[model samples]
Structures are given as structure tokens and as C-alpha cells.
Target: MKIKKLIQALPAFVMLTSTGVLANNGYVNFPYPTVISATPSANTQTLSSTEYWEVVRGDELKTGVAISFTGNKSVVLLSPQYSHDMNGQKRAPAVAENAIELHTLQGKASLSATYNRDEMSGYGFAPGSAAVQANKLAGQNATLRLNQKISDDDLYLLHVKESDSPYQLNVESNVMVQEEAALVLHADVTGAKNIKPKLAIQVSAPDGQSIPYHFTNDKLAFDAPLEHVGAREGMYNVVVHSHSMVNGLEVKRSVRLPFVHQRESASVITYSLSEQTAKHVTANVSLNVSQEGRYGVVATLMGYRDGKQIALATSEAAQDFSTSETLPIRFTLPKGATGPYQVNILELKDQTRLQRFVQNELVTQ
Candidate 1:
């Protein structure tokens, strides 16, 4: 009989020890490792400052505890489950389920907790993780989600809404450019009547030069001179400022665009006067021919006697060339033309003039 009683008591002793039940009604549970410092809200018991302090369940938190983290990491706390009381003869186990206040002074951190089978079924957290904002945890348990900063190349979206405003603004191609390009700014004020809109474009060149253009209409078009842009081959900023007034309310929006100036060598045609006479004048025209294709050349001659305009003649020609080539162009002056005259040469393609040159004097005989 004595041996059987001792065997029955052995099982109860193991259960009490495994559940962290002390003889003096104290219970122990696993503690977090990276908890650098913790201050309890109530001073019921003294906390140890040793490196290996363990926290147990059913501990009465006189006040809420404040925990601090040092690095970019997180911590998870799991509370143990207990069996229900049997026959009103056994007392139910006490468990601590209060919220812990976390303080992240230097780096980022997150906190999570585990739930049992019944609790997990009703909980709506995602499989692995869920992000919850600070304000979203009102009247509920506190769980932290990591906060991160955005990178430089990331795109951000902005939404603007105001009362009684019916205008919208949109911008395209805020950066990057090519040579001989134009910048366009557009505004949409479709159903807005009695509203005044103004657009302004300001350019700051690389060499400390500022150019400003303003328009009262909805569109502001800008085209920078190629020569001026080439001289300052660096970063350029184009700022667009928009203003509107509807029913005594004003709305303003601004955006800055940055781009670099890059240009290639331009194709050119050279003209030289070879021979001249009273009836006609002959000239040699040469092209470097960077690109091989058909080109059109238009030549005009104006005859002047004693510094007075007299006669005007025009001639045009088109030819296909593979490489650099020279051609002789002859312009027939007016009948009985005898005076010094001027010549103008134009390089054209499909009636669009690419370049123009003027030659001063050739005596027509």
C-alpha cells in the first residue's frame, strides 16, 4: 500500500515542477533575451539587473512595464496555457496577459505573440506577418510593426482634395532631356467657369543664368535655344508654378524638373564664290555629309547697283550623295545686270530650312 501511494504522488510532483509552480506560490516562465532594460509600473517585487533574469507567468504587474530595445530586431512573448478547474476542488492557474509598453530609442523593432488553436481560429492575422499602425491598436493589445525610410529612386504618390475646387494639374517628363527639345506644361479646368488660371516657367541654367516665362492661358510651352544650352552643358532646373482663383479662393502648385544638356556635332554646308560675270555667277558648295542621304540646297542672288536693290533671282536643287562631295552652283542674274550683288544659301529638307548662309559681294559683269 505504501509503495502504491508514493507512485501516485510522483506524477503530481512532476506536473507541479513543469508548470513553474513554486512552493511559495511563485511561477516562472521563459524571459526575453534582448530586453536591455525594463521598468515595472508597480513596485511589488524587485527586478534583478543580472544578465540572465527570467520572467514567470501569473506575476502581478503593479504597473505596466516599459521595455527598451537597442538594435534593429524584434521579440516575441508566448504565455503558457493551463487546464480548467476540476470539481471546484482545485484552484485555477493565474496568468499575466497585460500589454507591455515597448520603447525603440535607436533602431527599429517589432513585437509579436502566439495564440492557441481556438484563439488562432478566430484571429485574423495573416500567415506570416501583419502590419499594424500605432493608432490601430486602440482598446486592444499592443503589437508593433517595423517602420522604414524610403529610398531616393522610389516614386511617391500624392493626392490633393479641397472644397469647392474644380481644377486639376498634371506634369509630364520631370527629368532627362535631349538636344533641341521642348518642355510642355498642361492644366485641366474643364467644368470651372469664372476661374482664372496662370502658368509660369522658370529655368535656372548651370552657369547661374535665370530665364522666366509667364502665360495667362492654360498651357506654358518652353524651348531653350540650342546655342545657349550647349554653352552650359550641365544640370538645368525647370520649375513650373501654377496659380488659379475660383470664387475668392486661390490654389497654387509648383514642381521642379532637372535634366542634363547633351549635344552632338551639327552638320554644316560651306559655300564659296568661284567665278562671276555680268549675266551669271558660279559658286562651289561643299557638305561634310555626316549622314548619307538626299539633301536640298536653295540659292538666291540679289543684284544691287550703287548700293540700291535692283533685281532678285532664286534657284533650288536636290541631289543624293554617299559621302563628302562638292558641287558647282550657277545663278543667272537678271538681264543687263552690272553691279555688286549678294548671295544667300539655305540647306533644306522637305521645305524645312536647316541652315542658312549669306555671302556679301560679287561684281556682276
Candidate 2:
């Protein structure tokens, strides 16, 4: 039910603007339903009643003619009479004229172009060539102007194109995401190998505002504002860190962030240990395994003497354990021992489980 209300409210919700106009400094993010205005209601669908545009004297260039529409309604530029392309062109500049046109529903539409007159000003046009000024002059509120005399072709083109300017947001692609582990501060810790790692991402907005995002399993995403970290069109730093335990001893691993714009994903790795076995006397030796995903654990002890089988004991534990906890395990040595003995520890690699154990060597006195 809430979703329905949100969906229904989307249109008006999008039209809401932060400030009257966008910030002048380069990029400014505006929410949905970017409002566009033109003289004729035909130009701006949002306008009520009839809006008319006239080239009283000099060429009158329209403002906010660029058309963009989000999801539902599309922006339509309706020119009663004009037949040209984006540039100042006409099927008959001497007769029929052309104007700028667009079809997007949302986003800012800039309207401005260099003027031309009869191949004399090195501006004017032929039969079907057109060009609109792409940007606005700083501090000059976008408004119509009649600076010079315009032919019927130029006049008609202005009305036709300016009426319904349709523009589009062409999002090419996002560069690969990258993550890095926190700075390491240990002396004996080493990195793990041959395993996929997990990475945490932090996102911030241009104003330092922070937000949260979710990614699929084994994946992490941060869609918050860039300001979270002093946002702007500059280098933003992302980091990832991982921790686990082996044989009651903790282990850690990490990696640096993405260096290339095309790369963005990374993870930290852990170790694995197999089943353990001891000989002669009972002794607790530490074993370590690396890996954090789903895994299984198994432990066993066997005794052997002079190429002959002897008495033995076994122990096992299975479930889910992360690298963060120390697995305290205890075992007893072989009985009726009179000669040298050996203990063996074996780990089954085919099972779908992460396991690690510590190995210790001891003798009977």
C-alpha cells in the first residue's frame, strides 16, 4: 500500500526543487520532475492555459526549451510551422524554417546558439543546417532576445524548435567499483590466498551527507552521497577490511583500493586447516585455517608404532565458524605405549565447508 502511494506521488514528488534554479558551479543534482518553462503552454506541458512565443523584433531565443521527462509523461516540443534540424536549417530558409526539438521528460534543457545571417555574418544558414547555443551566459537569466533582424526561416525555426525541446540523459557506464582493507598495524600477520574476500563500502554525498545501500550476497554497495567524504568531482576513497581466527589464534587480511576507474570490486582472504592427530601423550597444539564463507570442520587422532597399528582416539565438530573465534580443542595421547609413536591429522577437502586446525608434536617420557 505504501509503495502504491509512493508510486502515485512520484510525479509531484519529482517536480519539487531544492532551490529555484540549479547551482551555477558545474554539476547540481536535482530530484525528479525537472520543471521546464516556455512562452506557449505547448512548450512546457506543466504550464496552464495558452503560452505564446513571438519574435517581435530581433531573434527571440527561448529558455528551458531542452525537454526531458521522467517515466510517465514525455516532454513534447510542438512547433506549429517550422521545418529544420537542431542547427539553424530549413527546407526553405527562404520559405519554410526549422527549430530545435527534443523528447525527454526530465532534466535541465539548455537553449542558446550562435546566430547566423545570409552567409555574410558567417552565421546564417543554407536550406537544412542548424545549431543551437548549448550553454547559458553567466549571470544572464535565460530570456528571449531580439538583438538582430531575422529572416522568416530563422524566426520560424526558433518557434518550432524552442516549442518542444527534447533532450536525453545519456549515462554511458559506471567505472568498475573498488574497495581497500584498512591499514594493517600488525607485525606477524600475513595475507591469505585462493579465496574470495568480503569488502565494506562507504558512500557520501557532495555535502558530506551519508546514506546506506545494499548489494547481493558476497557483494557490498554504497550509494550514499559523495559529500560524505568531502564530495565533489574528485578522488573519493573506499576501504574494506576482514578478520577471522585459526586454532584459537586470530588472523587478518586486507588489500588496497581500486587504482583504475574501470575497476571497483575487491575482498580479503582467510586460511584453512585439516583434521589433527597426536601421539604418545595428550597435548593441545594450535591449528589455523583461512576462509570466511560456508564450511565444515572435522578432527581425529590416530596412533602407530614400528609399522603397526595401535590404539587411538577421535574427536570432531561441525557447523559454521568464522575466522573471528578461537576454537579451543582438547585430545588425549595413546595408552600402553612402550616405543616411539606418530600421530596423524587429515582434512577432507571435498566437503563444502571451511575448516582449519593447529598441529602439535609431543613425546611420552
The per-model lDDT (C-alpha) reads 0.39, 0.29
Instruction: For candidate 1, give the lDDT of residue 88.
Output: 34
Candidate 2 per-residue lDDT, tens place, 151-224, comes to 43344323212111121111111122323221111111122233233333444432334446664543344544
C-alpha RMSD by candidate, in order: 35.1, 27.7
Model 1 lDDT at residue 168 = 42
Q: What is the lDDT of residue 312 in candidate 2?
A: 48
What value does the lDDT take at residue 86 in candidate 2? Answer: 69
Best by TM-score: 1
Q: lDDT: which candidate is best?
A: 1
How well does candidate 1 score on lDDT at residue 316?
Answer: 46
**Which clashing pairs does model 1 show?**
29-56, 41-63, 42-63, 277-365, 278-364, 278-365
